[model samples]
Every structure is written in structure tokens, then in C-alpha cells.
Target: MIRLLSIFVLCSFSLNAKSISSNDLRSLYSKGQAHWPAIQTSDGRRVEPMSLLPVASPKPEHVALGDKLFHDVQLSRNNTVSCATCHERDKGFHDGRTTAIGIDDQVGTRNTPAIFGIDQWQSFFWDGRASTAEQQALMPIANPIEMDLDPKIALARVNKDKSYHAFNKSAFNSSTLTTEQMAKALVAFERTLAAPSSRYKTFLTQLNKNPQHAINSLSDSELNGLHLFRTKAKCMTCHNGPLLSDNQFHGTGLHYYGRRFEDKGRYDATQNPEHIGQFRTPSLLGLMQTFPWMHNGLFDDLAGIVALYNHGGVRPRPRKSQLNDPHFPKTTDLLIKLNLTKQEQADLVAFLRIL
Candidate 1:
């Protein structure tokens, strides 16, 4: 079974930690062979330049069970809502709504970010509310607007389901599903929801081998856009590394503290005062597929988001804060006006689409 094999692989790593690197963990889990559907370095480890992040390891048996639970509406009070309602697979694992529409037609303030490689994330949620995906999974089920089911009720529902018994046994080594067991299973499944390979990745791999000819793969404009993204755009500062995310919160000066929908962003989580309007830097993995950008979902197009950066903060610092602090904090300096030309903006968008 996948569960037994995964555990064995991890145990092997434990017994011989010095012999295996974290990079080797994934290959070993795949039984030392996996066709990742992308190009690779000469060393055999694959590369996906689009996301720049390695593909995650094989999902465990609990992941299969979690996939079932993700689509099952039984987790909701009215039995009409599920995790998939917000993080659907068809639309790049996001509901594509400006804001999340949950049970009883309740709408959330922030947009539902498309789910992806959060297993490598240092924090979870738009505001960095939960430190881990396991903790984040538990909150939504109990939130009034979401599933609207208490933890006790959710666990009880699974307890009564005969089909879930085997999953609980395999995942938790128990006959009944516990809170910890369910959260872990869901996180395991979410880890597998990575962005698929794309033409951009193929281009990057080719470039690794033949830089001169590889430049012919993407259009001249796209190549110019890639250069701009790394230089003038300077996106690699925050959106860097394998996952193309720094996993840090940033304030973009989009503080709607008193409008129709007011979100405190990260301040609600840490109350550090400095975190007032800061939000986690989401990845650019599936940006072309997931739209209506930003935490407010106000910007409908990637060009709009790019323009916002081109012109610096859209709005000046809030005249006041709901937190009742004088002299509100300024938006991140990274948002400084780039003063890019129209053609450059179009070029950047073309590069993003291929990702």
C-alpha cells in the first residue's frame, strides 16, 4: 500500500539521514524513479523554471481518502458545501470568485487564493492566520461562513460513515476518525495539488542545455519580459526560490478598513500593530488560470496588477486606521513605481501566461 511504502521510505531516511538529502527524499519515495513530466538537470533531479520549484513527492494513501472527503459535501451542515467548493481542481484549485461564497450564501471578505505547494510554506492563509496547513484545515470547517460545522460534528459525521472507517484505519491506525487524523489527511492531500508542468518550464530546461538556441523557444517579447521580471520588475525578490514565494506578509496599501468590506489582513492574526494591512505574498504559479487578483480581488486582470506596481501604491496611506493608530504604516517599498512602458507590460503578461 502507498501508506506502508511511504512510511518505509521515511523510516529509511531516518535510519540513514546522512546518506539521503531532502532532495533525495522525493525520488526515494517514488521508489527511486519518477517521470515528472518535465525536463531535468544533468544530475537527474528535475527542474520546472516556470515555478522553479521541484514537484512534490508521491501522495500517501490518506491523500486519496482526503481527496474523497474534499469533494464530499457531508462535511457541511446542509450537506451542500465542501473544501472543493472553494479550492476546486478545474479552475486551478480555486473557485475563481472575488470572494469565497460559503454555506448559506455567505461571502468572505478576501479572495480565495488558489491552493498549491503550501507544504513548503512557512505559514498558511492570506493573512498568515495558521502556521501550518493542518491548522489551517481545521479553521474553515468551523467558520460560520464556510462549512459551518463544529469540530465535534465533523468528526462525528466521519465516525458514522462506514466507508471512512478504512481510511481512518489506514491513515490514523484507528477505527474512528479523530481531529488530528482528519487534519493530517487533508494536509497530505493538499501537498499533492501542485502546479502542472508548462511550456515555460520546457523552455527553461532547454535554455539550461543550449542557451543560444533555447532563446528561440519563447518569443523575443517573452524573453524580454523574463528579463524585465528579474531586473526592472525585480519580482524575484519576493517571488523567488523553488516555490516562487518568500512566504512573507506584505502591505500593498490596499487597506479597506471602513469600506463595504474591511479586512485587517495579518494584523488580525498577530496584532503586532506593524502587521495592520500586511498580507502573505501569494505564489505566481497559476496566475494565468486564476484571476481577479489581489486580496480584495478588485483587479480583474494581471495587467491591472502590473499597472498597480508600475504606478506604485494605488491609494495613499489610509487617512486613518480602524485599529485607531495615528500615522498608519506605509506600504512596502517594493511597490515603488516602476515606470514601465506599455509594450513592456504586455511583454510581462505574455511571460506570465506561459507559466
Candidate 2:
């Protein structure tokens, strides 16, 4: 009887241990299967993965030389500004402003986008005109509103520098300085400015191991906001994928300030009537830091942006350039109201802040 009782106790303990292990396995499997949320724009678009070109590390001599050149104002015509002036490290490599202020306090039309993950971008500029980072790097230096330097003249100036000459000989095995070489060095430096680690990235990693773990990691309000962003808010249409940019253009019917602002956006570059009032989508990573949103820096707050979308964007008029769908509901009273309470808006903003 003693032996039988001992056997029964051992059997019960084994069964309970097996059940606990099974529950753990199930939890991990469920967590791993959970899908990460994505964003969408009004135009029914999705974010595309950035295509990156493999870049070889610069020779130690070249990187050292490039670092000096990046900060040198002698490259500018007036010796008043350098790349560092606009792309300060503390501000996510973006000067905090509605638009970039450059040489002699010259104000530019477009906002200075962050340089992080620039190498991942296929096209540069708000217009998406420059196809390569190397090509895009030279524009600000030459732009009259920015560095205000002539490329040929800048190359000549660099050629005159004895330190540059020595570095060039050691790095490139040549003493010649060219506009192309200058652009290459700047591009190389910019490529290294990638931001990879974020809370979202951590979530992804945890999710792969166990989906419950991922969901558990996020705060309750963040999870709620994620549901709204993916479903009702419909932000996933454009702000999809890892980078949260569709790399496409859309007209959100923002008010432009210029008396006769003639900026045709993508239409100016592509000459496609469909592209009028359209501009490239920007990444939402580190968005909490880079503010005064949109291509024109029209909206100052995220709540305003969400409210605009909740209303289905501004109306299109004959003289007023519009980019949103004509068939889509305008922010007019005729459309069904989203009826999102103030707390919901705050929650949505909270989720975006996490991103």
C-alpha cells in the first residue's frame, strides 16, 4: 500500500509539470505569430523597403580627411557655414526649424530632413530628384540658399589646402581634388549615420521569440493606439513596413503661405499631372524629435495632422492645388464624423511617440 501511494504521488507531479511546460510553449508560439502593425496613407499606399547599396568603408585617411572637410567653412563661398551648421548631431542631424537656414541666414523652402538612414533611401530631397546619396550630397554645398559655394571653386579651394593635399595623396594615391571626390567623401560619412535600435525594433525581436512577450512589452494604451492606427485611422496605408514610409507622394491639401507659391511638388520634377501637389513620404522613425511636420512644414502638432486626416483632407478647388483623392470624403460636414474622443487622440499620439 505504501509503495502504491508513492507511485500515485509521483505520477500526479509529472502530469502537472508536463501541463505547465505545454502552457509555456503555447504562449511563446502565440507571441511569435502576432503581426507587427503597419501604416497606410489616404492614397491607399504601403511603405516599401529601402534599397541600399553596399558601401565599402573609407580608408582611415579618407574618413579622417572627410571629417575635417565636413566641418570646414572654407568650402563655402563666404566661409560662414558648414554641413555641421544644419546637421548638428544633438538634433538627430537636423536643424530644428520649419525650414533650413543656411549661409547668411538664408531661409530655404523645404525642411531639412534627418540624415539618418540616408543611404537606405533610393532618392534624396523632398522632390525625390536626386537618385543617389552621392549625387544628393553635393546639392546643398552648391545651392545658393545653403552653403552658397560653387563646386568647381570649392574644389579649387580644397586643392590649395596643404593638409587636404597630403590626405588626398595618402587616401587616393593622388594629389588631385575634384568635385566628384568631395561628394564621395560626404556621402560616405552620411551613410554611417544609421539609427537601428529602437523600442519598435526590440518589440520585433521579442515578438519573434514569443508574441505574447511582444504584446506584453507594449503598454496598454500603445497597443490600443496600434489597433486604431492599423484599422480605423487607416494610417497603415502609407506609413507601412519597417521604415513607415511608402516613398510616394500625396496632396494632403495643406495651406501654403507664399502669395504665389508655385511649387508643383513632384509634378515639377516628373511633369505628371497625377503627381501635382504630391511629395515623397518621410520615415516616422524618431518622429517625436523631428517636428513641424510635412513637406511644407505646415502642421505644427500631430493632433492637427490626425484631425486633418480624420476629416479626409481639405477640399479641391480649380485654383487650389490638391493631391488627395477627389472621390474621398473631404473634411467637410457632409462626411461621417470619426467622433474620436480627446483621450483617443492622446493615445494615438502616445503610440506615435513610441515609434
Candidate 3:
């Protein structure tokens, strides 16, 4: 669950044979093998893994400045919050709270996501409001309930920091800085946050060469759960690829009439009725490290997540503005009444932890 993925592969494999339809590629995942799509491009061509993905020149100073800014409370108006306030590094970059609390103890509606694999996200936030990491980085700083630092003040603070100039000179060949450069610096630091190797990754590495060794690594229960995850559970339909996420939004069908507020999710950003109750699919990597899951952190553990899916998520809660709940079951297609036994659910949770 991570990347200072500096190596970049500029290849044309994506333009040729479709990687999505390859039976061999499909087989890699169907047999409980982990998703490492970088092994080949979309055209099924051999491509070297770019070990040094150059994010804005890949300078060491960028990472240093970004780390300082990441934990710097001075970025906040009240000096009480930073990006790390919600996504603390020790907590897998996620705050150990049901919902994030910001400056002045203003509570947010969603759980703080783990930033381990966050740089790879196609969009940022539960609602997909920001399209780039640089854009996403600057948002919470100016959010009234978050860091509460206005963009004008934030720009001035960065521009005025004399200490930042040394790194700025080294990075930009001049002793000056801009808010965009600071955001880029943060992005540079974040790109280094790569997924740490796990038992699953080790098993996956050996699966093609020594299937027996890979099969032997996991217990009977874990293997059984992997089978369920691939087929009956249909988790891979959305939670696919190396990140174990499709990087798209889907509805989870969790609504509560008893709540004092409503989070319309992607609908809030797009104003599209079809997107109601939808949120970005989060990566399954480092799942065990992030407790109290879901966009709202409604569940406490892996078991709760599996069980919720097993029963097809929450039933339609009673209505708020109207008389009854919306009759639409707008959740993902795979979310059905999966009649899984308790042990099967437990095994599924076990497999998730292994990832």
C-alpha cells in the first residue's frame, strides 16, 4: 500500500492491442493473482517499470519542502490544523476518527482517506471535486471548516517564507516560490508514498513461476476467500487493478433518515441525479491499517465491511423531504443479496487483511 514512483515509462503499448480484453491478462486475476497492470501496457507489450517517475523534476528538495509543509500548522489560519491533522502519517495517513474534525472542532461528513495510494487516484475527494493532486492539495487549506487558511493569505505565507527560498533556489534555480510550486512540492512528496510489500504481493510474485509455493503461503481459509472474492463476491468488478480500485465512482446505497444531515456525494459536485449516493471506489491496499471504513466510516472493521456487502448494504431509510425513501436502488450492480455464510464472510475479511 504506496509510491515515490519516479520512474516513468513512455511507451506506445496503450495505442495497440487492448490490454483489457486479453485472456492471458484476465487469467492473471481470475486465478487469484494480484493486479499489477504495470507489468504490461494496455496493448499487451513488454514495458520496463519506470523506477523513477519524475514528478516535477524529482528533486530531493521538493520532497523536503513538501514534508515540512505537510506537517506545518502555520499553513492554517489558526495554526491548529494541517493536512496531517486529518491524514496523520502514523495512522497510515488517516486520522483514527469516524469523521474528520477540523479547526475549531468543526466536524466533516466523510472519513479521512488513507493517502498511501492516493496519488494514483484519477480524482480527489469522495465527491471527485478536484481532478489533479495539485488542485486537491490546496483545497482543504482554504476550506472554512478545514485548515481555514484563505488562498490569498496562504499564497502570501509561502511567498514570504525566507527559509523556503534555499530549497526553492535549488529546485527552481531561483530563490522564489509560488503556491502552485508548493502544491507541486506536496505532490512530489506524496508520490513517494508507495505500497509496502505484503504477503499477498509476495505470493503473487511467485504464482506464475511456482503456483504451489504461492498456494502454500496462504491458509485454506484465505484461499477459499480469494476464490469467493473473484467470483461469488464479485469484488474485482470495481476493486480491480494494482491499486485494487477502479478509480471510478459508484453508489453504496447507505442512507439514514435518522441522521441530521445528508451527504449527496458525487451528486453534490456534478448536480447529476444519476450520481446520487455515489462516491469514489477506494483502494483495498493496506486495508488492515485503516479501521472504521467507508466514506462515512460507518463500520468499525473488515468484518463490518464484508457483512455490509453480504447483505447488499443498507436498506432504503425512510424519507427526509418526502414521505418515503427514494425507490431507486442505485448502488453498484455487484451489490446484491450475496447469501454468504458467516465463515465465508469471515474468510473474505481475512483475505482483505492479507492484501
Candidate 4:
């Protein structure tokens, strides 16, 4: 009798569930309304249309100084690695490595995030430890596994560089240079690296003008993928807004706690039990350009990632020893099984590639 009732409830839900149309999505996005079948995050934020501001316009001298600083290897302890080494422009500002290889070929645990569109971010890094760009800029230089160079050493090196003298003076309007001024210059240059306009943006523009041209803007498969992204795929729940990220942390069950691959994630920053497996939700702006996704850079192919999400993310069973651990992170309830068809998964991947 219970089995029969469960079957009936499943049938009822299947009958009631409706796929959201592209036109409906466009209409709601235009008006900033939450599309149906969407839910508020723990913080009460919902999916909204991406609204990017024009690229920030900082002083030309600051940008020039920052550009030089970004490519300068003298800042590293061994004079080998520079900021651009990890954030290559052709690779969408990502190093394309499974994990970042730093000074002396040291391997860091976390993936290198892209620098694109970072000027708009409130927090920096996978753990969200750094609150400002200045703070974020200086951290990697001194990281033991990274550049392994002291900020004081970096400052002295830049101060001694004759080529940087004019830019340093122009950026700070002073003959004397400081670490804060250098960080501000780096931030100024990075802010200018905003993502270029995409087909998705063009589609949205056409939708605002008239929904007819949206078909011409995107392919049938891409459109279907967009629909699935919002509806069945449930991507918009966390990856929404102009940046396509909620800028919040949620556990996707990849932390591998109490195991050899254990990564404490945001818990390392806060030391809070609730944040054990959580990492910042990265923007999907340059999704395809950056490869080896996730905090650990575990998955390289988007198809595999889609499959993971289709099965409602990785739900690792706790071992006998871990069963008693109170901080064993549970994947967020937002990741319900998607049940996407193979074709639907392909379509979703198609849409993601264009992103």
C-alpha cells in the first residue's frame, strides 16, 4: 500500500511539473522576477538577470604600472613565476592546470581562479579569506607554496626597477613607493580585464527589444540548454545574476573530509563546523575558457560535471570512523537529482560552452 501511494505521488508530481519556456524566462528576467520552480538560497537571494556594468576606467598610468607588475617575475622569490604565469589571457586568465604549480614546482591544493570580472567581486579566493583586492593581491606573493617572496622584498625590487619609476610615480603621485600603492595598481589593471560580450548577452538584448530575434542569436540546441539550465538542471539556484554566481558558499560534497583528499575548504578560514566543505560559488562568465573546474580541479570535462550534478552531486557515504564526526559535511539540499535526459545533458553542455 505504501509503495503504491509513493508511485501515485511521483506520477502526480510528473504531471504537475512544467518546463519553463525561453520567452517566459526572458520576460521574468526583464522585470527582475524570480522564474518559477526556483527557490531562495539560505540567504534569501534568488536568480536574477546578469547586469554587468561598463568596464571600470582607472587611470592609464595605474593600468600600465599594474600590467608591468602583473608580468614581472622579479616579484617572485626565485624570479621565475609572475601573476600572468597562472592567469594566461589566452586561457581565459586561468592556468589550465589541475592544481596550481607554484615556485620551485610546488603544487598547491586549490585550482587557480580566473582574474576576469574580479573587480565586481566582494570576496576573493576559494575560501573567501581576503575581503578586498588589495589584500588578495599581496597574499600569493608571500604564500610559501606560491611565489615565496616577502612583500618587503617585492617592494624593494619594484622600487629599484628603473622602467617602473615613471609608472610608480604616476600611479601614486609620489616619488616614494609603498606596497598599498602597488596593490592598487595591480587591482586597477585586473579590473580592466572584464569578460567580453557574449552570445548570451546578445540574446538577452534581443529579448528586451523583441523576443523574435533571440532565435537568430542562439541555436536550437543552445536555447534548449538555456531552458534546462533554468528549469530542470537547477543551475540558476546558485549560478545566477549578472556574474552567474550568487557570490555565496555552498557545499557540493567534494571536500573529502577525514580522507587523504580532505580539503576543509571555507572551514579553514572560519573554523566553523557549518562551513566544513563549502567553497565560494565561482562565476560562469568564462566557464569554458577555464578548465579543470572545482575547488580541487578534480573534473576537466563539462560532461562529467553535468553527470555529477545530474545525480545530485557527490554524496559520499561516511565511513564507520567518520560516522561519529559531527562536522561531516552534507551536500546542500538544493542539489536534488535532475533526471536530465542524455540529449538534455548535451544541450546543457552546449549552452555552457557558449558562456
The candidate maximizing lDDT is 4
Q: Top TM-score: which candidate number?
A: 4
Point out the higher-scoring one by TM-score: 3 or 4. 4
lDDT, model 1: 0.67
Instruction: Please list the C-alpha lDDT of all candidates, in the order they appear.
Output: 0.67, 0.60, 0.66, 0.74
Error of 2 at 20 (Å): 26
> Which residue runs of candidate 3 sit more than 4 Å off their true CA positions?
1-57, 205-211, 317-329
Candidate 1 lDDT over residue span 1-355, tens digit each: 0010000000000122224443443333233112221221212322233334556664477897788778878889899899999987888888888789999999888788887876678998889989988899889899899999997898899889999878878777787987887887887788888665566667656655655455566675676565556545656556655666667787766766556555678988988878877888777666666766677666666666666566654455454443565536556665555666788778777877776
Weakest 10 consecutive residues, lDDT, candidate 2? Answer: 3-12
Give the clash count for each candidate. Answer: 0, 15, 16, 1
Per-residue lDDT of 126-196 in model 3, one digit per residue for the tens? 89999999999999999888988886687687668887778778776677677888888888787766554
Q: How close is candidate 4 to the true structure, as a TM-score?
A: 0.86
lDDT of 4 by residue, 1-355 (tens): 0010000000001211235455654444444223334433323445575455356888998999999999999989999999998888888788988889999999999889988776667789999999999999999999989899999899999898888878878888766579999898898899888664567666655665655555556666786676667655657777777777778887878788888668988988899999998889887776767766777777767777776677666677899998888889997776666677788778878988877
- Model 4, position 336, has a per-residue lDDT of 67
Q: Of 3 and 4, which scores higher on lDDT?
A: 4
Clashes of 1: 0
Q: Give TM-scores for every candidate, taking all chains together and pairing residue i with residue i.
A: 0.80, 0.76, 0.79, 0.86
